[model samples]
Target: MASGTVLRSHAGGYLVYEPELDTVFQCAARGRLKKERVSIFTGDRVELDELDSEQNTAVITTMLERENLLSRPPLANVDQVIIVQAVHQPEWNPLLTDRYIVHFQLELSPALPVLCFNKCDLAEESELEALRSIYEPLGYFVIFVSAVTGRGIDDLARTLANKVSVFAGQSGVGKSTLLNCIEKDLQLKTGVMDHEFGVGRHTTTSSELYRLSFEHFPEIRASQTASWVGDTPGFNLLELKHPQPTEVVWQFPEILRLAQDCKFLNCLHLVENDCNVLNNIDEISLGRYNSYAAIVSDAQMEYSRRQVTSQKVEATVKKVGGRGGKEIHVPRLSTKYRAVSRRRERQGQYEEIDTDDDSIDDSLDATEDDTFQDGIVGQENLD
Candidate 1:
């Protein structure tokens, strides 16, 4: 038996790296894991059997307990996220940046996100300084680097050391370029951002873990710096599992701290007369405030939609239970069919009524005739 962490999941198999021997084993997971619907993902520590040291291969038999897991790309035990942003190419969309923050906040526990501004050489000094001023005060480490000039690559690499780090950012933000610059041996393929659209093509199609080398830095030991970094494919925007509307405040640390002073416990800060967020500061940055508002509204809309959908799902058409649980889909009702049902009920009632009006009239006429005959017979006897 051997132990290894899955470095990457490939076609029907995984690339497992064993730290004990600094070796990699290409292995397939046990069949039972699939039957149980347990997913095998990258960064999972697994127990391997059928080991062949000579061939560096094995079969994974057990998946160990995970520290955490991010279901979006299914990476486990991620220590931190490096959110890359190009300074100028995509025009530094602050709303997009805010959205990315909200993304990891919901997905990653303890939510460690370091905002990295890449391609700084292409942007103005004022632009970079603004981000540093805002985010640094908010307890976020903001790294300004120029992949083209190899600036701040060392600092970025050192930060990722002794931690499992993953890069996330918008397309064309130079995510791959930054990694390529950090480790020359990686030589990751980087795509050029489109001049017309200002968006970068997807250069890295999949997420894969790459080992970081500190051999270049004599002060840093390669053995100590031995760590893993995963570069995922860039996206225009990540689909998010929205937080509750009231929960959106917690996503913004600066605002959340001030929100405690609000008069209302559930202050969204938009229409609150006594919002501490507004009282504490004249106003949050327009960009930040707008993003906050947008997020809250989006969340509220999603919550409403979910409630409606849940109501529909709960309104069962028919339940076949206690006899081999079968269900029939309830069909939706419309006015036309409802009217037809009512009409059929009325027609049935009409048919059930007795038609006795003609009999009653004939009985009345017969009684009158009998009275007349009796009167004539009595008169004859008197005479």
Candidate 2:
């Protein structure tokens, strides 16, 4: 059996790359692999049998242990995340950038995120430095590159060596363009596999790993380190899962530090009296602070929204009948929403309906009293 790493997972099979033979082959997992409830992801190492070196194909018999897993695309054994963001055009969004960071932490990714600013040629150097100042202090690797002019391309390329890095950030931030610039060979292969090989474009939506070679681009990386990159489509706008209300600040290293001086241990830093974050707001970048506030609010709000949805979705089915037939009874779930569920909670409709009913009853009572109160009877004339 030959051992290989899965470079792409789709089409009910995989493109496994065996370094021993220095070749990539199309392989499918054993039928029992699915029965065992094992999921195969890109970047997974597996044991292959029934190898056909001539056709460059094989069957994956077993999957090896993984070092880690990435969120969103959910690739395994990720070494780093290249957080690419544009310097202009769309403008640098600090909130979205920070949100990605929090997403990484929430996923418990062991890899460090590399902050890369693309389109440096369009924006000013001061703009680039401003971003660096915030994250550099937190021990993040920051880079500025222009896909047009190839600025900082070689530097960014060198750092990717020996690491299974994934490019993640907002769309239209020049991720594809930048990658194309760094790896010229990508142009030769735009779409997925061809029909003859039964390896057409990956039918699955899972992320696919592309192997990087020093031989292809000698100017960038000299050594082959099993380096691969996964272009995580739709992962650009990473939606964070619900986090605890108090756990939001802990995600921000800068804010969490000053939060120690807050009057309350659980201070959320949003308009709280004597709040250290608000009191010393000038000490931090106002933009970042605003971003932080919005992130926390969004996380909390998202959490609340999910909770309401879950509560409403929980349903109990009841079957009632004798021996003839059975009736499936599904009870309605409570739709009561929390005060925080909405921006402003309004009064219930029951109270308004009751008030209107009471008013109508009072009018009827007066009408009845007046109709009977007339002592002079005109009913005899009518008869």
Candidate 3:
């Protein structure tokens, strides 16, 4: 049995590698391993038994513990999540960046989050200044690189040396191009530069590891260390599931210190009567508050919208027969309505009465009385 890490999982099976032997086996895990609910995923170290030397197939028997689990791409042992944002193209989305930063900050202990600004060739001097002011002061290492110009790739190359880093960005941010620049032979398809928006199309569809090197361009050598990078497809803008409000407030160091002065114990930093956050909201970084508002509002709106939509969906389902053409009996409107219905049912008075029947009957009687009075008045006029 050889121990190895699973690189990727495909339709047939997973790619398990025994790094010690430098042998990767393509096989599935035993039934017992799955029965015990032991999940084996990409980047998971596991013990494998080689079944056939001819086909190079093997069986994963045991899974080792992981240092960290990046849930989005399902990566198990990772060093850092390299967040790539473009200066132009889709533009710099501060809210999305904060969401990613806070997500990694809450999930990982070592705080391995690196910021990489791709397409820096188009970055303005003001953009660079803004990046330095926002990220550098927060003790984040920011690297500016352009895949086309081969600028700052050396520094980025050194950063990825002897480490496992994942490159994540929105579509058209040039993740595949960056990877291709790192490994020349990898020659991963590069998407066309969108003339309208000045962004590349999403060419890479799967998350696969590419080994970085300076063999292709010896002149670009900086450090001699084996490194790997994972390129993932882009996704829509969404808020991360942060820790509790109290914990989440402390994620931004500036906000954490300012939160001590908040009047209420559970203040969410909104315009509460004596909210310290409100008083200092403008004083501190406006970007930070903007991010907070967006996340909080997004979560609240999502929950409320889901609730209303769910009620409508349930009502529609109840009206139409559910699966198998089964009859669905909706409960009475309320406790009062249920009590009345129960009383009527006990007396065998259920005849599907119209809800407005009594009101309509009373209206008809009143109209008839008025008409008869009018008729008597007309007779007096004639006499």
Candidate 4:
């Protein structure tokens, strides 16, 4: 079997690139893999069997272990996730941006998160400085680039060198356009901004990894390191998984650091006394704090919902043996519908005997009295 990396997955099959031969093959997964329900995503290292050299086709037999996998765009073994946001047109939204940062932090903890703000040409110098001031201190690598003017493209390209990166952001933020500027050969489809709705139209519908070439950029050409990038479909709404309210602080590094100095070990930084985070709130940006508050609120609600659901499950469901002796949870039967045990039925029968004996005795006494009265009446009639 030959080893290769999956570059794309489509309805037809996968496109696997064999680095040893520097050859690309159109391949389908083995039937056994399909039956096992193993999913193949872009950036997955796989083993190919049943090669047809003439047809340039093969069958993917095995998927190697991944370093990390992201479920949102469904990419594997990512080194960094570069969140591409716009500086103007769609308008830079801090809340949405923070959500993206927190999402990557939770989904792919090992991978680094970089912020790349596109359309810098349209933004003022103050705007660019303001962005850097907000994110740079947070240990995030920030890049201001304009695909139209090609400003700061080199810096962006350097960051991508020798890494498997993913470009993700809201629709119509120029993710595709920026990539095309870096590598003109791609010519990825670019969408126009919807002036009516003030959003960018969705152009990328799926995720696909592309090998980057720096032949035009003389500085990076000497390094000769291979760089792969995946362009994923853009999205606007991001729903975070339910985490504990206290755990939400971990996503915000600034708050987490201050929380360590709080009087309470599990300080939420809200209205708690001696809360270091709240005491030093001025150090944290207002926008970041607002985002943190919103996320914590959502997490609290989700946690409550889960708690109620668990209680209901415990109350109404019971474990029972199934056909093959496997245990399963079934709904508990109501009291009126439950079967009575044989021992209990016998006990009830014994309890009713005393009441039956008393009724028989009373009937016998009444019969004796009636007989005496009848005899007296007959004797009087004869006289």
- Tens digits of per-residue lDDT, candidate 4, 1-383, equal 69998888644478888877788898777655554445677889999887777898878878897777776677888989999999988889898788788777766663458999999988999999999999999899999999989899999999988999999888878899988888889999989998876677566767789988876788887895789999977643423343467777877878878876888865678888768899999999999999999878877776778788873211323568877888764434323235778997787566644333211111112221132233233221111
Our model 2 lands, by Cα RMSD against the true structure, at: 24.2
lDDT of 2 by residue, 220-307 (tens): 5556656888765434242444345666676666887788678886678988887888888888777678877887787677667768
lDDT against the true structure, each candidate: 0.70, 0.65, 0.64, 0.76
Worst 10 residues of 4 by lDDT: 359-368
lDDT of 1 by residue, 301-321 (tens): 877888888732122022334
Go through the candidates in order and give the clash count of each: 1, 0, 0, 0
Positional deviation of residue 115's Cα in model 4 after best superposition, in angstroms? 0.7
Clashing pairs in 1: 317-330
lDDT of 3: 0.64
Per-candidate TM equals: 0.77, 0.72, 0.72, 0.78
lDDT of 3 at 287: 89
Sorted on lDDT, best first, the list reads 4, 1, 2, 3
Candidates in descending TM-score order: 4, 1, 2, 3
Highest TM-score, which number?
Answer: 4
